[model samples]
Target: MIKIPSKRKRGVIISGQGWQRLQQAKRKMEMQGNAGESYTLEELSKITRLSSNTITKVQRRKFPVDKQTLESFFKSFNLTLIDSDYAEAIDAPPPVNRERIVLGGQIPLDSLLYVERPPVESLCYEAIVQPGALIRIKAPKQMGKTSLMARVLQQAREQNIRTVTLSFQLADTQVFLKLDRFLRWLCAIASSQLGLPKRISESWDNIFGSNYNATYYFENYLLREMDSDLVLALDEVDEVFHYPEITADFLGLLRAWHEKSRYGDGGSVLWQKLRIIIVHSTEVCVSLPVNQSPFNVGLSVELPEFTLEQVQDLSERHGLKWKVDEVERLMALVSGNPYLTQLALYHLSNEEITLDELLKTAIAEDGIYGSHLQQQLWRLRRYPELLADLQRVVLSPSPLEVEPIQALKLQSLGVVRVQNQRVSPRCELYARYFKLALAIT
Candidate 1:
């Protein structure tokens, strides 16, 4: 927020709780290294989407009494005012629509819905700069895999590593038509991100070929050009798994690079300075050749859904004072699925609906989860074979044995769970909801 200085406005005093909450937010951000005069303040404001003036006032203890604005500012900084006796500076009612529930979406970095699961967060951090480290982040979608990857990248940035995030989802269909085009595209993008000149033309030899040329550019040119280690993060890597011809070679290249880091066999100078992070939903069909797949070799981190305690923390942040029973009831329905639990709570916090109503109508066309469920429904319709498999899985009284590939696909969608080769709905809500939705199939 660009500021134009004005005459000092009289500061409004507030209750101790109100002032304390503001102080906490200021202190936390300060601890996160946002205590500078201009730059830190701007970074903080950018993350929180709150005006720098609002943050300054809150710190001065004369924060404006706008409850929603104050709440937003606090939430952005991951602060929740204890709802006991806090009073606003003005005592004026906020507009009815002041706060909008973020029911469905990617939880932004500012409003990062992260519950630190020890070991996983620390492991990913450690692996990123460990020299040719291949950190594999595997989890179903909407299960905070991307969220965790974002944090990993942030950690790398703090370590002064050159970071580049490439999403295979961004690759056009034509790029995947051939192996050469795709590999060239990959190396070119990584080179551009590192601010290195593309040396493909000079490095390419008809004898050595495109893949080797890409390697030549990376190993011979780009890696030598780097002053610090480079962290190349690839998200949505599952997209490439569908192309077996490309998947084998590309994954092998990564594994080979990782090996080079440990022993500089032929030429490993720059290879050791490159760390790779590959994030994917482990729902792919084909298993790469034993020597080719990089999954088993690297540091693998699987993101589990939020636990009950994690939900409690998130609920408190939402300003919803609920008992343990309430959280459990919500959990029984969502079964710790991060997105669904969030959907139910966002409405509950706003008093738009009760927990019971959310669960009861969650799968309904007009319910909060309607659009999200419909998206899944559409995908299922594409693969009738998969739909038939789900139909059986959902209707069965107990977990049913299913094709391994189908099970992997369903589990990846967060629609079912596979235990001992038996498949069942992941949550009570899914069982009840999909049971009705897939009845006709």
Candidate 2:
């Protein structure tokens, strides 16, 4: 007797056979009714519970279908294969077309002109070593606070002063809750910047060692490890206020450091060797005593937006060929905002559109910048009463009757400018944002 090999049990497979059988059954069923016409891709997908692309692929027989997929297709169309004659004609779908582009991350500062305040490099060079003095930088959002500080740090490095710049923006509520952890993190950053060994240990009893006092630990550590005088620039210092205890503790420490430098046992040794600079987005509102406050301790430097001349210089630097009048017109539209001015210049540089065309396209319905304009409008619309107040002031041309808080918020948002008792829109950009806000709301 010839020994016949037993058929081996194979693992489960998901084939396109069931799909082919289902398609044939559906065609036959339809032919019996009124199936003289071929089924569209949409119709096939609806019947097979697969995407149009997938059905098209199966029709091309581009690849073998798995058993599970075939089962699904059959179940979706309610069909069963009775024989092997139903599985050979399938195809794959066409490929999708996609475009990929890399974007530049850094804004070219050379192409940017400074109109309001001097360039950061100039300010940094002008910085005199008044060891006991503090420099406070305040600005609205995106007004170049970080850029200026970076320039200052660069200048400090050039001047051979040891500089340690730290930003507290990433400190969340949890990190701020534990003062020790916060101090250690700050110290570690300072250590890294100052080229000192990281001596922070979990087993350490005090955050500051014996040689360094709690208030002047940072200064002490730097002076002990490094020979040069230190320039400590702290960014986003206002964030410390998010935790009241942390804010109080940090401010108190600053006060102690300030005192030790001025009147400590070393007779101006610590104070004369240290320069502290605190940069914030806005004036922090903490409920600390007046003497112990940051407001009392530093020289306030306000960062203002660019002027028309600066914007023109920036345009030229960016290789944008614009007449003086054209530059002025663009400034009128964007209100001398450095970022917006550069953005508008960028858009304009890519095309030969006229100023009027640019503005119309930027503000028109379904235009490129229209959505951004709409978003700005929606932010103001969220406060209807404020919008109403602004409109009333604009229409009737009178002084604002709203509270100081409301007015300040509007000013901060770059919407309104207040001079003496008169309040008006800052520029055409603000007027546009406000008008859109009113129209949409």
Candidate 3:
């Protein structure tokens, strides 16, 4: 039986073999009269203006050659590397068990709903030398906004795009009062992700040095330090809208950077070389006008709930043996809600329960759907009149304008859908939960 060497030992052996192969290739080219046509390493370095050390590293398989170096090398041979076999070999394998319950840092998988966006990796090559465009993903809670952002960052890395993802979810509530700390944290995160050699504190100090205004520092230093176009995704941006003054100031800086990149001299703006993607749950209100805000500067992408077909696909992916009829029945119950659909599927997958049993258990006293129902009830406690108004709207065949706020809130929660002055529960599951919550409350 052949036994493989340990990873470190194998790496050394493989690298040596690869280096020998490269030398052999060079020899074959020379025998084929290509020696006079192709430049030597030193000669190629002089022509491409790259150091000999860089060429030596590539030949030794110490590190992958930069795109420019590889391009120059190919150009020397009157060939292109765009469709080379070596380029395909550089791609890493996808992660095993890519599907998981929890995604990103804290979002539960059952709650996530994947939406198709412009593939993030493709943008890297297209925007390599140009100012990267902004991406705005707008969605409601439990729609998988954070998970999608995580996937985008992963895709960016696979495409050799330098990427950084910062979530405002963990930002201190005191961010409004302590702008400097907020700025420092943002810089530290960017620095860490970029593998910058400088310490976070040093980088921060260098950018903000004795200057209280962080806006200038971010535009001038932090953005400038990004050697290549970076894909920076900021999640939970709507959370900042609670602090209007800070939100306006920060977003204004982003707008300024974008504008400068468009109209100013080449080196005047850092955003000319940085790609920014901002994601947020829709807010009830905003400090800046929706159209005029910097948040609106990018392509505004909305993530919707899965269609019936998608829900079935998700169930199949989870290893659930769901029939078309079963899938339709479940969709009728959950109204294609990505989260609740998966939650039900998970329980069904774990336990040998019939559809009727699952439905009954969910609505029974102190059951799974019961708690969710009660929580919505608790939210309504502060406004009993609103709750009563909603109950009336639900019971009434026709919708009334008197309960617009209650109706809007219910619709936002994915509990009810309004159509042609008629009010209807989105699905049987939601209806059961709402009824249970009202009953116990």
Model 1, which residues run further than 4 Å from truth? Answer: 1-105
The digit string of per-residue lDDT tens for model 3 on 197-289 reads 534454345444322345454556666666656787888886676676566666765665555567766655565666677787544344565
Model 3 TM-score relative to the real fold: 0.64
**CA lDDT, candidate 2, residue 290:** 79
Q: List the candidate numbers ranked by TM-score, top first.
A: 1, 3, 2
Candidate 3 residue-wise lDDT at 390: 61
Query: Model 2: per-residue lDDT, tens digit, 1-441?
Result: 965555443323223343334445656645665454445445666767887445434433334455455555656556653344234323324235321111122232321232225323333434525566567777655566676676556545645778888888765567778777777777778888777787666324564542244345555455655777788888888678657766776876766566666775674686666777787754455677877775676566777777665666556645677788888888777776655665676656655555688777666756545665666567666766677767755554555555665665566555666668567776676566556556556
TM of each candidate vs. truth: 0.76, 0.63, 0.64
Pairs with backbone N, CA or C atoms under 3 Å apart (clashes), candidate 3: 101-109
Root-mean-square deviation of Cα positions for candidate 1 versus the true structure, in angstroms = 10.5
- What TM-score would you give candidate 2 relative to the actual structure? 0.63
Candidate 3: residue 270 Cα off by (Å): 2.7
Poorly placed runs, candidate 2 (over 4 Å): 1-116, 119-124, 201-216, 364-401, 421-423, 438-441
By summed lDDT, the worst window of 10 consecutive residues in model 2 runs over 97-106
Q: Using lDDT as the measure, which candidate wins?
A: 1
Question: Residue 81 CA error for candidate 3 (Å)?
Answer: 14
